[model samples]
Target chain A: MPEGTFCNRTPIQSEKALKRLLEDTGGKTYYQEMKALEVDRDLLWGTIQKTLKSRLRTWLGICAHCGMCADSCFLYRISKRDPRQVPAYKIQSTLGEIVRRKGNVDNAFMHMAMETAWAKCTCCNRCGLYCPHGIDMGVMFGYLRGLLYQQGFVPWELKIGAGMHRVYRAQMDVTDKDFVETFEWMVEEYEEDYPGLTVPVDKQEADILYTVNAREVKHYPEDLAEAAILFHLAGEDWTVPSSGWEQTSLAMFAGDWEACKLQVQSVYGAMERLKPKRMVGTECGHAHRATVVEGPYWAGRPDGRPPVRSIHYVEWLAEALRTGKLRIDPEKRIRVPVTIQDSCNYIRNHGLKEITREIISHIVAPGYFREMSPNREHNYCCGGGGGFNGIGLYRPQRNQALITKRDQLLATGAEMVIAPCHNCWDAIRDLVEEFHVPIKWSFLKPLLIKMVQVPEHLRPENS
Target chain B: MYEFLAGPMFILSLCVFFVGLLVRAIWYVRGLHWQMDRVAYGMYPGPGIKGAARSIGYWLLPFGTYGWRAQPFMTVAFFLLHLGAVLIPLFLLGHTLVLKAATGIALPAMPARIADFLSWAAVIGIAMLALRRIALPEVRILTSAYDYFILLVTAAPFITGLVARYHAGDYAFWLSLHMFFGEVLLILAPFTKLSHIILFFMSRAQIGMDYGIKRGGINGKGMAW
Candidate 1:
């Protein structure tokens, strides 16, 4: 989190100065590869034309430049209102360039445009929900990125992320063995606490199919253990998706639009095999945003499978809390002043704000959620949300993005920034260390599990 | 020569402006092309009774009473521009007044406003809106050159008419300037964002009506308020 960690000492300002971007492109701009893929040029232009025709007016007509967009961003609030970074404005400029091009810009424009449009926006559509005009900058950015990718404007980080998306169906290409290993680790940890608890994977025909971001398997495995304990206590009939269980779609974040559809289709393909009634996104924002909002729009669903019935964990857990199936005493908040860092994807993707807080109130200090200015759908991106954390080049700009966001965490004087999404946690975790705060960060599942009051019948007599 | 051109431009601007606004109203009432900006805001998330009521008010006001009261300076200014659009051209130049004088109702006195001071007020109001769009950074930020051009396109007739009526030309000269500007705006209105003026009330209404019927709706405040 040292501001220097993301510093590119020489900031490239103009098209001529961005030669590093071209040679540094990690060797493929999709426009060069597009004709070879045989993706139709006319169809590409038509979609671009249609999207602009629909949005340009509102894009130009926004009356409230209240900088509410910066407020709504997790990156900004987490960075203490850095005043330098605003995703909406970043989007505005890129979109402005595209609009200025009138849809006839060069591959170079596409390259810079892609970085700002595709890489910058998570396509979570959080700001759109809060916009006074309800402008869908995410949707606009998505199409603009898709158009750039189609025309050979691919960036290096986005290019590699897209490739990873192909390999693992998420950003980091962890294998099925890795998923199983992660689950086994969780099972072993959970058994030490509750010997009877079953953290079963690929348990076909289970009522619920649980999923989590690849980040959990790779980094925050403690969160997975929390899942096992909570489900064991609740006696829920859920199974880890044997295949395609990772709920992080970095493809969506990378501006790899085609890969995004394919990644979600794989999850549904796995869902069909398990045939679970419902699929829950593991605290990851873009994954759920894609699953509910965008995934349904795509044409194919691996074997042409229909879209799955999906909702986030907050929805399911909050429902359980409301119905008396899940219980927790707020007074037993062992690790509070616990402030909930609302993930932008969670709010922008699903408008699940009320439910997110309602669930937290059951187990943690509801007051622990320090109101990051513009939390919820209006909440800022965790500069690292989406695939930006993995984008090596945008790191300092990412740091710059989180100036106010860090200040918000410091203001609360809390020990933890409880983010549900893995990338959100990872990005904020970096910021925490760098901005010089030691707030232990985590998702709701692990925290909930750690605080659960073991029911009398469930208590082990050995103690 | 003036007879033929003046008659049509005069009647046509009046007809198109009046009729185009009506179609825009219907489109609004019916909620055509609106993707529901009202829904997510919690002002009216659903297209239910409340939304419908809101839409109805939004539509009727521009055509009826509240249109004047809501944005009086803007409404009055627009009303004047629209009035000058019709009266000056057809009456002064198209010979409609001479033609209709036999049939009865006389055109209202516009060139002569109440005590003359209100004439300056109307001119000043148009200038104020134009200045606001240019001076206010947020409003300025939203507008494009095309947008500013339309505002100027609209202002010219009144401005030229003000000059022509006071100093140089006959009613015909002022009439031609008014008709020319009116016709250009009408023709371009459908294509540009300028159409939003004609389109806003109806869009709001349809969104309002849509919200009126729904079980739960998103309104203006980004919540279910």
Candidate 2:
């Protein structure tokens, strides 16, 4: 493996800059919230009382304190086994400390608790698989985040993203007109390659309602083009709603359940108005988890029933291949050795490991695919999940936490690493630059375009 | 006094254990809401019941979870200890003999030699766990005095029984002491972290149903422990 193939240009925000951003956001900051918690201890206790339920209590009680989960934590692994960074320690300090103090901790205690709950652990849920008790520490951290959120201690970027989602129905604050313009622009660019490619915006009664990460519009419009190419090639009836297209929710990451609810509700509202038979998300893992898994829980269905069936783009592509709707040109199959980096949301949280591989296998030739040691559900998080990447305040610590993951990627000895999740892509991209790992990163969409072909008659120009 | 401790106090401790467990169970369940996270389409790839069974059954074996796999020696030690502690109490010949005499109901007991070996294994397991708590920095930080207290309470009956059965102490005196410790452990079971004896299955099942059945595409293998 080579070093520093990509330049390490990611800005490390200074503490003062972060504080200034927080002040500009204009609300009670975490310090103020902690002071408030110190004065009215009952408020903190009341929140804990409402939130602490059976599963969490069971997790707290059942943990044998065996320290077996410590080695499983990437942060603990990379940080030279610092006891404070252990997954068990994360729970013990935040939830356990709260319970021990009965919610009457001081401002310093709250500050330490916030650091442990937010910056130390990514809420990746990798530790759950390692737990003999099957305790989902990710969910526990979420509940912890909720308490911290009440104290106005959420990470600044997450706070801003959630605020954007609540106010503008987009995490990046891309308005409806901006979104439509991006789609039109991308469609125009895509038509050069696949003539007559149309990026449908707010197409009513479409079979599939496609959602995207806000980053797709703001940073990587070419990803949208790839998705457009795949959908167009597959001959699938899909539409991207002008509103509710931004799929990823930093609100969920920040523990702002209200903003999270607004994001989900907006998606569902768009779906209801469009009446799509089903919903599909782009190759973004957390977005899929939010829209399909946690969204309904936070934002209820309109009729109080299940929301429209939600599927990941990988699943959609694999199904298309299975049914012969799409074909991969074996000649185009990636001949070089390639490995996959499973996003925590998709692998550990959703169990899409095989499907992820299957999608890659179609694009990559047999025996060319390499599995990372401890791949799939056991894969290490990219240290980007759970809103960790969104918070610029923890940038240095976040990069430090990626050491184990950097080692894992290098160990694979693959030239290209396929990361389906946007967050994973961003994290791996940074880690590759910082650690100077030689692996080139590619997402599933571009790979599918490279390796798969749409039949001539299905092409708009041919028709 | 022997009769009072063995017969009346034993029964009283059993009552406290059962009643306390029942109360806690009710409290746990009553707090639950119907709204839950759901499976995305094609997430669960297998049957729900089988996945749930696999989930609960997997953790019952040594090296079942990823954590246990990482620490093989400790996993085996804990497995052996759990096997002995759980099995011998229910199936030891002496225990069944006494229960049959008292209640006119009995479960078939293991051979005497097997029962004796398990009892010893349980004691050794408890000792190993205690040593680990004392020696390991990670475990030491989390280990409270209450944790050690609970360990003693749990191990006392097994040790005293071994003493009585092997005539290491006066048989009658050791038997009475054994009965006393047994009663105390019973009374403490529901009120202490020992409640995991009952709660483990529920937590595993809840995890299985949520991750295994719902999110793991019906088979819940995605999040299997």
Candidate 3:
């Protein structure tokens, strides 16, 4: 998320894209269009202003600003505990600027405010649990970000995300054939680790629908390999579809609510066809968090929402451990101290945090977890999820989030940081390098396999 | 020349102040394009009769089923401030009240007895709130000079009325002068930060029921608490 041709490409790219869309759309008014989306503008919205007042006033009255929110903000932790970098201040001051200007402001002011709003926060809501006064900054910013996106004010990388979502139907430009090919590749790679492994495509009546964060197919292919390896070793009947395989949803974070609806529809449509007894959301935190819970909720479920069972990777893996089907080798790991990062989305309403510990304890000793200072339910973001890592405009904000993570890693004195999700791994890895912090990042499953104490008698053929 | 300028200037200020504020509120209401879906991230289920009914409550009762409705103390404060505001205006010599009720008996100590006590008590109200505005971090962050001025203008008529009543000698003339300014405060009350007096109930009622009921829910992200 740092130092690309972002600045150079953004100006022309944004200008051209905005002009192109507005030109094609026939003079759309952004605000008017947003208020009454998917409807004709000629229909008079009599209560439109009344709706705006309640929303704006609620937004205005929402924040209690106790600074507990500072704990969850990635920027504060990454910036070595600078208070200004905390998420609460970002909301307070940005909204304060809007109020001070009486909502009539220039683009420069908006640019800075939007950066703070969109990038500085991961929309994780870890802090939301701790709040004595429940103000949802994630929702506030999400709504505003959606409005901004309509105005062509989204981050640089996310333009591509929106495009991918629009055309290719994935977070990245992942296609149906590419998805199938990757699964075929993963099956071969996984066999070296766990023999007789098979990842099926469009398999009817599978017991589980396992969704991988799209990052697995693109950059973090080892995760897919690890997932396949683990699932095979555990002897679970899971299928990764050629269609509904990619699950890391940037749309949830990009504030593209419509896009989010479309995604859930696509994923669920595939689910209805496969008829999996349960859906296993992968190690990606926000993806799982957004998909099963928020996505279905947002879509209105107008005629009653689908009731697919949703479980976290940790919970599923922990269940796998109980079955005694999965085992790992501890000697392959770095053998230094390590701690698990509890992804906010998976932990809160889903309670995957404890299960993550259950996972680490199943493989490594309890003492290996040095903990992330303000850890567990109160964990700071890794400056990644909620589309921040995918957004170029959020580089500095994401960099700020990296500050606390760097400090935390330095304090842990651990050799490795086990982040369960790909985006978290990416953010942690970037910050670890960017801040010159001496720590390596690993997905929990890979590290878990590394440290699972693979007996010398049952070593892999390569070993 | 002096009389022409003085009378016209005073009239112009009153007219501009009152009309400008009303215009602003009207413009905001018209421009905001507000609705139930807009609030709480479109969280309100907007339960038909139940939803509308839940938003309104007995003004005198605390814990009335409403989002921003007044509690007993706040309601008392509301009545005192508003009653004192309207009643003070009624007693002004320019109003038809004095001419009809008094006819000649010198205006009943220029604002009677009960109205006078609340006037003095209002200073305490203003002070308590001003202290609150200064002390609380949330309130303090949102404070402005206009807020202070509005407080002052609000307390002004009461202070001047009290002073004019007890001061004697030219007290009647001073009372008349107090009445004139008191009327001015009323003229501007609905527009300025004073509007919060009327607005606080609406805000509290909707916000209350929004968070309170499960059936009528609000959608949106949980805030960065």
Candidate 4:
């Protein structure tokens, strides 16, 4: 609280340690690769000129210098009140400098801007909530990312992931054959418990078309198993498309509009062919919001494509419960107290907090479900939302910044922390491990699978 | 000097202020081009307009926003500063007499006691903000020379007017000095950060509209209001 005693509560990482960690995480190597790229001033200036619309122009001009947003930033708080970590300072340094230079900045300046845009800020938009003017920092960072992407200054992981999505239609390059095989494998695995289980693939005109993050296929296949079990128990007509099953988009985070369109079009194009009534995107916040909320704008369609409405996984679950398709036994709920880390994309940006709370209230036993303070839209980000999970450059700083979130979770004193998002799950799990926080972490679906009851008629005959 | 101070110089500054504001308005609006492409899902005008209405009150009241709830001191300081700045100038009996003499337009003025309280309150508010900007390292880093200069320019009229009222110096000289600073501020308003007078409403409304339509409601979690 006092001068020189700021941020004494948390262990802020030193610059030397951060650079060392960047080298250790191979972020330094990536920076060197970035420096090797050809610099184009004309294209950079043209992009800035095109994107500096009136809204952003006004925000840049009208900041009152009250510093109300400083307390709202996790990075600034965790970094012991570092001036550079302040959200306004970060924006003023990058976009402010761009405006000052009138977009005619050199390569050296571009490199610095890219670091601030991609590494320093998470683009979570929490600052917007605390800003009296309600400046949308997330959208501003998004436009900044767009400008950076135009100059081919994207992070290595995002560039590669976007390329994979363009060519392979999935982040991990999971082919059609492999995707079907994985679904079949999940069906076989779930059938061991619920004998009549089926993981339908390419089923045309199905009521629900389920999509997932490719990481489920490459790393956490059990999440797919959980989905298969839920659908089977509900007896709903759901199918996974063999092609375009991947819904995650690196292009959205990287701010590559062309690639974003290509990736979204691939999924919707496949859905248009299959003709499902609705598409249930898996528990990946960025992908869910991008596909459902932002796809219209990115694709240049004013009216969003409505034939197959894209819904978050929790929405699908809430609908199932409301319709009596999926039943849960209140008695079978987990005994340990649990808290939620509201994904910024889903809750803050999209207004899914109420429904999320509704679902959690039903799933967790009454005494066990403790709501984290600043729970709903006001929740702190998990430090991984804006592709920070994949970008190795800021791993050390990110870990340090995550202390605020870690503290929020710790304050709840819950044994289990539910992150209904893949990125948040990874980030929360990492912080739990790093800080030695005595809590288990999970995605919402897996926990739901544990408590949800399969009807006797839907269950296996023998078991 | 008094004749010029209250006559042509005042009218000339008022023209600069008004014309400059019009130019700024036109330039900002003309540069605005909507991209029907990326407006988020569920974005519609009904919620945006309603949200803008609610947001006007939300932002106008100093304690009505979450930022104020989080940092009450800063919020109070700003509220006092803006309240004094806008109200004292518009309602002061001295200014009303000047306006009546200049344009043959008469308007009611606040009681002298209330005007005195407002003037001193505003001066104190300005001092607090200036001290915070200069003292707080986080805020200081973003503070430009223009920021300090504008603070001085706006504060000079209030300070000199108070001094002239008390006859701290030659009454006419102090009054002339106050009028000169007041005219300078009017001339500089549109071109400097002082333009926030208009931009605050415009920018806040646009943000409220965007958030309201995008999220389908004005009241919800994480909203500043």
Candidate 5:
């Protein structure tokens, strides 16, 4: 209620422990370790000075406080229109205040900023489209997260996520060896069905150097099999790099800039080593964003691109369908009422809206595909972007935020929601779980594999 | 006091207004690290410029963007405030006469009645915006004493100009106050949030090019949404 203070409705279950964690900064847990870490005023201010570049300074200086961004944000809309959820207010109160104070902030302020950055905003970049001045709170929040990460104020999951990238070069504990073995094992399971199906590993000069999200490698090895199946049937020269195969960057989500650079560089390094004509990442929005869109910048590539051309899985799917490499079986196409969950990282931020539509046209039967209102770039986030889905501290807010997407889904009258991106798929799954919605969700790879018209030569002998 | 305000003070404020904006623009450009910032400015000039133009053009129109369309009343007030702030001062007969007399440059002027109407509209617009800042919870939460101060300072010139034109108060007193506040507004323009008049274009262009070049906003993609 007071000036310069956030509403901070994110409930802390253990107040005493939180207090102790804040005071001592000395627990073995990631959250406690981050909480207990000492505030480095000098480093904080130094980073602030370094990051106070043209974009940020102009955005901060030019904001008219018109509150247009309030309605643009799903968090603001779904939280009963909470003032604190307003994108302009959220960024201004946190990053705006930090810069105003020259980063001479206390531990409490840092924690408050951490909450606002990770919880209130999802870095969806939706609000950027609506701002009259084009002040992107998403980009600013990302920069703020970098500052927060430097000061050890990141959330437990993201901190761990970043550490995983540092330790394993992947978001999970899975190593390069595990990834290669998992792909081999998963492909072998499907080998009998599609004989001679193999996941080409570390194959140099392959036309398409395929990469994947660690989630597919860990929880959903079947996704790897599906990708391999599709590529095999399409007769494309694709190989998965043993190293840098994990495309999603939790480091990017964590606002760990150094880790972000490191994570993306590994992928770039693989691209350089493999000499693949083009790289296609698995169905993950942020992975594409991390590796292709922002990674080049982070890795300091002069052309602002990776070593080889990188494309999203949707692009590859669309291209394959368009080029007659992969044909959808009309009999097997989706006939039930279905809609799409457009991943903001790609659809909005990267302008891959129509590419997904191309894929949808092929896979969905006539009259089966229903479009969500405000689809494509105008579509809302899955309420679990920017590492919101994984953080334990903000689960309530994250779940509450799903109301926007839920209402969108319900209005479409779709029994199934095809979420091409992994984050959207997971968020939709969580949304159905939390809200008990009847709609089922899926990634495109599995759906495509089922619906694709297998060539006579590529098809299993018995089938 | 009248002579100083009308002559030397006005000149001084004008110099500060232009030089201040120029210096601020230079500082902003200089602050940009070429590697970090400029690399994302979009590789293709054609698409980047197109995106930038579209971005600025859309926001200039009343209810042009999704944000504006959502808040109809605020959009009306915003346009009224900006149109009056830009148009009335530049095209008013009295201001043109003053300009012609001072700089020996004659300029076309709008009708007196239209100028009066715009001044009234501007005042009402400012009042509406100020009311929203106080009334709307979302806007109010972001507002501070500094925001209020900015509003008051911005409104002073229009209010005093209206009073002086209509002979509603002491003519000399109101006229002097109008000129003084107008100069103050000019002096404050580049240094405060008022700099948005110029920087708005820059911010929009940066984001536009960011999407246009880096993302697929160009080549007939991402233009619709």
Candidate 6:
């Protein structure tokens, strides 16, 4: 309610002011620009009226004001049971109030709602499991974010993320050319170690069309090389599309629905063009959720499926190990006490809980694998889903949210943590970094590459 | 006055309850677009039905779900209040006699003593729920004036009926008050948050099907948690 700057930082007051801010987009950072952007009441109301459908309406209507959802949320628990952190209270106060008032809310109200939507909840969908009424406040928060985005009330990083997808069709500025070239370069770097390893690009009618997170291309291209080595060792026909290679959708986190459609369509278009029997995405949680679980609905696929049969990297890995195509060297298997971070996006939302376990059984030595209490679908989010990790404005809250996960990991007395998804990996990394927890974390690929048995023929001559 | 309260007023309340709920259901369904909403439910009918059944079935039992198990006191209070609200009306001898008088039909009735016990149990349950709304910070924040009003409206019949049964006050006054509050509850059920009575099933089914069909929960795949 402070008057100087809306939400204490943004000076936006009217639609015209928002328009002027939009025109000058380059003078300051995206966050600074966002702070100056004004509320667009008509657009917000129009979106609410258009998108507030029966699922949300019934959900909003039937919430019994039960605080049972309080414990289901890690934030509420971690924040010392702050009433505002309660999942039901968070959604009810923000989205519920917006709907109750029919979008007649002001900038301060929108900003508060934005904070709750981004910082308070991770859209992990765990509360949906706990609610007797099945209210799914996480889903409602996602819907609320769409309304906030329409009013330009999103966080600076997410706004920039949405723009990246809009302009480059990737989360970061990694172009289609950059993704393919990076994959080829990474494969070349590993070719000396694993003889005859090749990066397949846009191979038509391949059994699997491999996709990857843009972060892998921009920052950790070794993920691509490891994927190639595994697929090559498995002797499976796999191809990565030259374009549409980026699998993660920050637009989803931004709640920019159009950009979500655009990003997923790029991946779906790759599937249509190459016509792979199935598509296997890299080890990223929300990427799978964005492109596989929720992507079909965004793309308006009738059967609620991607163009090709899409599976997570864990699914592919589990299958490869089960079929004896990829064998784990028993001596090389991880001997240290290790635990798994069950990513909510896939494990809970997509039902891939056991598949990850299947991969773990092969990679970890017997009796070395430890399970986090309240694991799998009921597991706490890694405190970084729904774009929480990237937003500087909510960094402190995001860091605090990790306590639930930090304790869950520490309880296992594990030295290493196997986090299969990129979001979980980043979060667990940040958690260890922030809390100085002794546990080390790695993606399945890094550990798998180390332990996977190299076929005699594929091995380099000197080795 | 007894005849009028038991006959015309009771019928009117039932009519409003049924017709209002029907309208609400229609309005809810009308808001859903087939392509946008229905398609997201996925195409696996077997898993969808199984998920829906499991979700609703588990929730109906005492200590059935993880959420219920987390809060022991609230679970006990909730089930007690809901069971009395449902069973007392259907099986109590006096209510059955009224129904028989109106429709020439008979329903199996519970012993008068047992019905009396249930009424008290329900009253206690209501008090417990009301106490949490006031005492628990998390629950209190979400509670509004309307929530307390709804709780009062919901508890009115059982409390008044108990008073009438014990003859603790003027018998005719308590009986008439019980009948009047019961009628008010029926009329308000569909319009107020009490709509959760019916909508809970629909909401639970939607989420179950969503998880089942789209997420492989129907095939018993990832539901380990």
The candidate that achieves the highest TM-score relative to the unseen native structure: 6
Maximum-lDDT candidate? 6
Clashes of 3: 42
User: DockQ of every model listed?
Assistant: 0.11, 0.49, 0.05, 0.40, 0.54, 0.63
- Considering the two chains of model 5, state its CAPRI-style docking category: medium
Model 3, C-alpha of A166: deviation from truth (Å): 1.2
Q: Please give the lDDT score at residue A234 for candidate 6.
A: 96
For model 2, residues A129-184, the per-residue Cα lDDT tens digits are 77777787878888888777666555657656666777677777578888889878
lDDT of 5 by residue, A156-250 (tens): 66766776777678888788999999999999999988988999999999999999999888899999999999999999999999898888898
Kindly list the per-residue Cα lDDT of model 1 for residues B1-225, writing each as its tens digit: 356445655556556756776665464444322221212222223444455455445334433322234334445545554444435444443234533543344654433543134434446656766665666443444445765676677676556656665766676777667657756766655555556655544334333443332211331222221
Model 3: residues with Cα > 4 Å off, grouped in runs: A1-56, A62-106, A126-132, A302-307, A327-335, A451-463, B1-142, B145-225
Ranking by TM-score: 6, 5, 2, 4, 1, 3
TM for every model, in the order presented, reads 0.72, 0.92, 0.63, 0.91, 0.93, 0.94
Per-residue accuracy of model 4 over B13-89 as CA lDDT, tens digit each: 88898899878777765665445324432446667677677767787887887667777777777887788788877
Docking quality band of candidate 3, CAPRI definitions: incorrect
Which residue window of length 10 is worst by lDDT in model 2 chain A? A1-10
Q: Each model's interface RMSD (Å)?
A: 9.5, 3.7, 9.4, 3.2, 2.1, 2.3
Over A203-244, each residue of candidate 1 has an lDDT whose tens digit, in order, gives: 777877888777778877877777777777877898887677
Instruction: Tell me what TM-score chain B of candidate 1 gets against the true chain B.
Output: 0.57
Lowest summed lDDT window (length 10), candidate 1 chain B? B213-222
lDDT of 5 by residue, B15-126 (tens): 8988988887777767756346624553578877877787788788887887788789898898889889999878999788776766677889999988988888999899
* Candidate 3, B125-164: lDDT as tens digits: 6665566567644345555676678778888777766777
Pick by DockQ: 1 or 4, better one? 4
Candidate order (DockQ): 6, 5, 2, 4, 1, 3
Candidate 5 clashing pairs, residues 3+ apart or interchain: A25-A36
